[model samples]
Target chain A: MALEQGDELPELSVTPDKYLTVRYAGASGDYNPIHIDEEFAKAVGLPSRILHGLYGMALVARAATEAGGGPASLARLGVQFRGMGLPEQEITVSGTVADAGEAVTTVHLEARQGENAIIREGVAELRR
Target chain B: MALSTDAVGTSYPPVLYAVGREKVREYALAVGETDPLHLDHEAARAAGYADLVAPPMFTVVYSAPAIGPALFDPVVGIDFARMVHGGQAFSWGPLVVAGDEVTTTVTVKSIEEKKGLGFFVFESVSANQEGHTVCVGTWTNIVRGL
Candidate 1:
């Protein structure tokens, strides 16, 4: 697929199971109680155990890379955590080629849960 | 307690991580990555990789030990109970595959107050066994005020 400017990458959607956060915490070695212990999360002012911000970021990165080229083609991926991500809700990752340059291409991507943007300002740089 | 601005520029000891095939596969599966390059060695080799490729986000595991000090430093005083991930950025260099040894060095990039919250930034650089950079990551955290 030619990465022409304005070309849309195929959208990827994932619904993390209720225990996804726990699995992610273990897989990523980011055993923060706020991501696993519901009681601990509530005490800390969150509604409940929330997904690790990196989990959503990774999914978005994968979506961009899978479409742009592949893992090795990804030069950079950046994102800001704008909203809390709860498990059991469907999250969608979508993006468009923002700049198709001779040497590199940029993809403006985002991850959303319902109407909320969980990973905002998503940017991915792909090497041609 | 809030992280002190004085902690900015503090450098933590470098951490060495041995990239394992199973760990790489586990991380890819955990993130729901279905790419065979990250899951099958033969596919990775066919794709020009030496082994199963570690997805870009695997930097989280390889750099965590180096980043831990800044979040736990007493002088820095991060309020763990109220802290949350704010943002993340990564720039990749050489692709990381299984059997590689990665060493990550971390430094406190900044600490400041923004909108009554404490914002902390840490910069980490991971290098392959050959000393080629594998990834550069900027990690941000926000601590809500009392």
Candidate 2:
């Protein structure tokens, strides 16, 4: 793929569910109640069990990797958790090639669940 | 009590984790990844890897245990009940292949108190048995005031 600055990368949409969250909890070893127990989350003032922020970041990384050709192409990825991601919501990841260098390509990324921006200040660098 | 800034610069002992092919495949599937390199050993070998490769984020699975010391330190006084993940950053070096024995060391990078919340940064560096860096992950946690 010919990557260039100002080029928009393909968007990736992921709809997480309770089952996925449970599996992610087991896979990631992050058994935080806010992510696995709805009753605990509600008792703690959350609307419901929230998805792990790393999961959303992984989706963003997947978009970068897909656009860069493969997983090995991605060199760095960073994101700030801006808002909570609830299960069963379609989270959309979009990005633009911010800079394309001879050795690396930097892409600016964002992930949103509906109108709420769940991940902000996202950036990914891929080896060229 | 808020998290202590004194813990900054503390380093934990390296923890060893064996990356198995089945574990890698299970993580890839759980993350909704369908790439052949992560599931098929032959395909991965054809792609220049020794065996099934792990997804970039899979480092979190192996590195999570290394951070337990810092997160649960009594001196740091971190309240798990009020803490939330604030951010995450990763820099990859080499792909983690199946059967690779990885060692990770967790370090408390920084800690800051602001607006009644404690922001702590932890860095984990994972390297293969050959001492080649596999990945470095930085995790941020926010501990809200009670």
Candidate 3:
């Protein structure tokens, strides 16, 4: 779909499997213990291993690309980490086109896990 | 101890990344991406890309290594134990195709402490082998109870 003002990006709802952080760590080379080791995370005062914030942002990027029609259409992505995201819960990325210009369209994105907002003030620019 | 404000503007030598096809596939799978444009070479070619497409966030892989030096640099003095990923933003130029060699350079954009919290930001520029800018990334980290 050609995104225009007030268009909604395809909603992406993903539930991270138990090994998601482990797989993401290997693929992204971000082997931080807080994302992979449950024991280490609990030791550091977290409930358990937390999802990588980047993973959540990536989903936002994917949603924009999906709505923009292709990967090449995405020109920029910005996301803010507002709360911790745990595995096994539904994380949803949803957004609406805020401005549609001749050259670019701006999509305002937000991500959430239940009541917690994982990414707030998210934005994406797509070539129009 | 507080972060070293002087660390701002410290630049690191550029690092090069060979954008491998399989690695791109791994990342797409890890993120549970469904677009054939990113996963299937033929689909990407069908849609005008030269090869498998690298997701926009793939910039992280090329830029993370450079962030390491900035994170560990004594001049920056980040307390890793207390630091947490705060946010990320990227301005992309072109779609990164598999086999495109990308070079990333990072610099400490800012280090500031406010109300017992420390904020660190790094700016990175990634360019393709032909010297065209591929992406610019900004990474933010926050230290608690600083």
Candidate 4:
């Protein structure tokens, strides 16, 4: 089913812990220490071990692609990371149609972590 | 030593990056993007692109390392371990296909200090083998403790 203007995507959640951190490392080849070790993160002044920024963005991208119809349908996608996402905290990816037509639709996307928002804004363009 | 804000607008010497098909394929697969336009040059030409265009976001991985010397310049006093990504944006003109050799130039755009925290904006431009401007990327990093 293709998402239309004003259609809300089913909310997706993730609590990225050490295992997920390692998984993302294998998948993305981003070996940034702040994402994997608590000591490393604290040594750098982060509150705790954090998820990779791209991983969080990837979740939002996955949500948009799946909810808007699927992989072969997307056109343009863009995201900006705002705040750091820590481990064991739940991240929620959600979206609503920003605009749509018979052949294509644009969705406003977000990924939020509790009281702190990791990614406040994004746009996903998908086609039917 | 603290970095002097006087460095803004200075462009580093261009670094040549060899575009590898395998890297492009890995990125596309990781992103779950199976667009043939990003993989098969013949298909890409059929679709009207110059060749197998790399994904727009992939430039960051190739060009970011070129800025490391300045980012960690002893005079700069930035601790990569303490740095936090603030934001990033890309403005793409033409597509960068696989098998294209490109030159990348990175520059510091701005730095803002507030309450002992530092926010820095860095920009990178990637040009094609023929020196055509292909994409421009602006990324922000925040450093605490002024």
User: Could you tell me the lDDT of residue B56 within candidate 3?
Assistant: 88
Return the candidate ranking by TM-score, descending.
3, 2, 1, 4
Task: Give TM per candidate.
Answer: 0.96, 0.96, 0.96, 0.70
Candidate 4 or 1, higher TM-score: 1
3 or 4: which has the higher lDDT?
3
User: How high is the CA lDDT of each candidate model?
Assistant: 0.90, 0.89, 0.90, 0.71
- Pick out the ten consecutive residues of candidate 2 chain A with the lowest summed lDDT: A17-26
Candidate 4: the clashing residue pairs are: B116-B146
TM-score of chain B of each: 0.95, 0.95, 0.96, 0.86
Model 1 per-residue lDDT tens digits across residues A22-95: 88998899998888999998997888999899999999889988887788789999899999999999999999
**Residues B7-71 of candidate 1: C-alpha lDDT, one tens digit per residue:** 88989888999999999999999999898999999999998888999999999999998889878
Candidate 1 TM-score over all chains jointly: 0.96
lDDT, candidate 2, B1-146, per-residue tens: 64467878889899999999999988888888878999899999999999999999898888988888878877666787878889999999988999999999999899888898888889999999999999999989998883
Off by over 4 Å in 2: B1-3
Share of true Cα-Cα contacts across chains kept by each model: 0.82, 0.73, 0.87, 0.20
TM-score of chain B of 3: 0.96
lDDT of 3 by residue, B1-146 (tens): 75579989999999989999999999999998899987999998998888999998988887788778888998888888888888889999977999899998999999888888999999999999999999999989999977
Model 3 ranges off by over 4 Å:
none
